[model samples]
Target: MNKSIETMWKQGFISEGELVVPKVNDLYNRKSQNLVDKLQHMFAVNIKAIVIGALLLLVVMSLIGAPWLGIYICILLAPLVLMARQELDKSYNLSKGQSSLEYLESFNAWLHDSITRYAIYYKFFYPLFYVGMVSQGLASDAGTRVMARLLKTYPTDYVFLDIPGYVWALITVLLLVVIKYSAALYRLDLNMIYGRQFKKLEELIKDMRALKPE
Candidate 1:
């Protein structure tokens, strides 16, 4: 119908030649931009949180004579923060000047890959971070005080293991348990952090996929 054709054209849904679906493209582009903005904002907020947390940790470590643990936290998370920045840059770059369904597909793939890598890296390092923190603390004056109190309370002879030894055993068991369930735990954590935003992206991608260019 001529009327329908004219309406489609007016809506920027169809074109005469190679099908330049401007409406669809523009919609996707706006969504991509929104996602990029969210990522940038999230990155900024995460960096701030990391800095604040690091400072607090450093203060605590200093008070407890376990400065190395604070340093370890900074060292571990610094690279991750940088990686997030790089990923954000890549996302923005991918979204630039391109708003087709193909672009949406590529962005979807990129997001999935980036998130997978992030989860992998996070799971790998999370236990190490905890181990370093605990190890450093256990070697500090604070640890000695805690050990003394624990020994006084529990009195090693009961269990045939000293307080510190029992603590080490407990830490080892915890490490094993965490390592075993790290993947699932990381997934839950990621879902908590990015679930809503990721769902939006998925929905946009699905919508774009359904739009067939003529």
Candidate 2:
């Protein structure tokens, strides 16, 4: 044990004669690998989900006669899905023969960057998602007929300003609801994608940082 500690000290992973913060051992390495593997699994799941979601969205839009909108959404989401797969692949190709601390540090940096980029991408992408779905639904055959009837029936009832009263009122209300909840939706989406694994990685990183040699 003393010899291993001395060797680790010489390797710059610990301070001379100081206690290791996370107690460097096989257990530590295993835990790190487990956490990282879990994250990779999540990325894999997300890739599949994205593909499935794209297909479903395309089918829905095509049924509604808005195949173009569905195609557009797939195009927008493709990059995000690709990005995630790329990151996961990169993580799996981690450096061989690295010390546990070095491995964790490298993983930490990659995980941090990956999480930030994914969050940013989703924040921008989701609003577009919301808009595409809503607008496409409204442009569908049934939707158009409903709007036509509403306008025909209540031609003079202005909901607000120059907009028709009942129709515009409904539109205005839906729009406001979407706008009000956009931030919350983004948070929810991100949490669903990266929350648990992200927090685990964060806690591991924190523990590793605490153990860093002074």
Candidate 3:
């Protein structure tokens, strides 16, 4: 551990306690960090997929006109959706790792603080970030459809229903479901870990009472 981190822990900057549970680490205690890292990777992959797929579809649609773009869009969308599912696996593996030492504390206090910290960084930040990505696709789809109508490739009054195109979008929705379910399962595991970490935290609190801040 970094000496600064140790000093902060000692000073109650990170938390007020002695973290006595070392190598016998809990998986739940370290999940949020791993989840953050995996999401970073997934976002990178999504960018590459979006750019490459959109560019390819745009070029093909310009040549063949609108109806064909739907097929082309589907082809491109497949990878984006499939890779997103793959992201869930990455998060799953990330959630399984061990930490060096976890600050043991009361379940109410620790769980509340940890969840609050993570909700700020993960739920708020990540959703805002990913929402921007979904918006990009929606914009691209709208732009393409509108252009197709302008070029006389699509009927002006025709209600657009790209069966294959939506398949790709549906896949993304499915991947999100998988990610959510995995997160829920991980949370269940975390509740169990909270019980153990809380016991360890009580022990550490007792230990702290026996030591001075020398």
Candidate 4:
């Protein structure tokens, strides 16, 4: 390992979940700055495309004053939402009793759930945890476009808007789906290994506690 990555690993800088501090020398950090710098490029290529596409459809509807598309947009994203939910459920199921995070003794002792010790945290984080530093601006324009498509009531004119917003919106949604899907699978694999380890620890402790006084 390079000295920087070595130091980061030694310091336990790589971690998961809501605690999403970026580690030094990580791919998102100094070690691969060039790669991380393309995060916006990825978003522009992926998310922005689809969001814009969806908005364009709405715009097309507006130019003709069509009413069908209002309800269509409502249902248009249903499949994506369903797929996202399926991805999340799969991760939660696969991550049962795995360790994705841990705090010191006192920090955890206060938690009431036995599974919260280390294992269940895997499930908690398996859905939305950032693996490395986030690809900042990866989906920045998605939210704005989604809201605009949903709430805006402006007149639609195709001539001024040469660019394809509907395509951008569709690409954005697909990118989010793919990213979440991959992370879910990665989390599932990690939790499966750690889940077994936790089970073994439980068995070992039970055996030791049952031993007769010597």
lDDT (tens digit, per residue) of candidate 4 on 1-214: 1343334334543243223344321322232222212322332343344455657766775675543543355344444444434433332233212211221111122222323322333333333333111221223355446435544544233211322355345545755664556545645654574454444434433432343134
For candidate 4, report its TM-score. 0.22
Question: Number of backbone collisions per candidate, in order?
Answer: 0, 4, 1, 22
Residue 48 lDDT, candidate 3, scale 0-100: 70
Which stretches of candidate 3 lie above 4 Å from their native place?
Answer: 1-20, 24-32, 67-214
The true-versus-predicted C-alpha distance at residue 208 of model 4, in Å, is 43
On a 0 to 1 TM-score scale, where does candidate 2 land against the true structure?
Answer: 0.68
Arranged by TM-score, best first:
1, 2, 3, 4
Tally clashes: model 4.
Answer: 22
Candidate 3, residue 69: lDDT? 45
Instruction: Name the regions of candidate 4 deviating beyond 4 angstroms.
Output: 1-33, 78-214
Q: What TM-score, computed on C-alpha atoms, does each candidate reach?
A: 0.72, 0.68, 0.26, 0.22
Residue-wise C-alpha lDDT for candidate 2, range 1-214, written one tens digit per residue? 2243334334544333332644464445556666766766677887898899999999997896788998989998899888988888777666644565666678778876876777677666766776776666666777677666767776775544333566655655766676666657767877887787778777876776676568
CA-lDDT, candidates in order: 0.68, 0.69, 0.43, 0.37
Highest TM-score model number: 1
Q: What is the C-alpha RMSD, rounded to one decimal, of candidate 1?
A: 7.5
- Rank candidates by lDDT, best first: 2, 1, 3, 4
lDDT for 30 (candidate 1) = 56
In candidate 1, the residue pairs with backbone N, CA or C atoms under 3 Å apart (3 or more residues apart, or in different chains) clash, namely none
RMSD for all candidates, in order, please: 7.5, 6.5, 13.6, 19.2
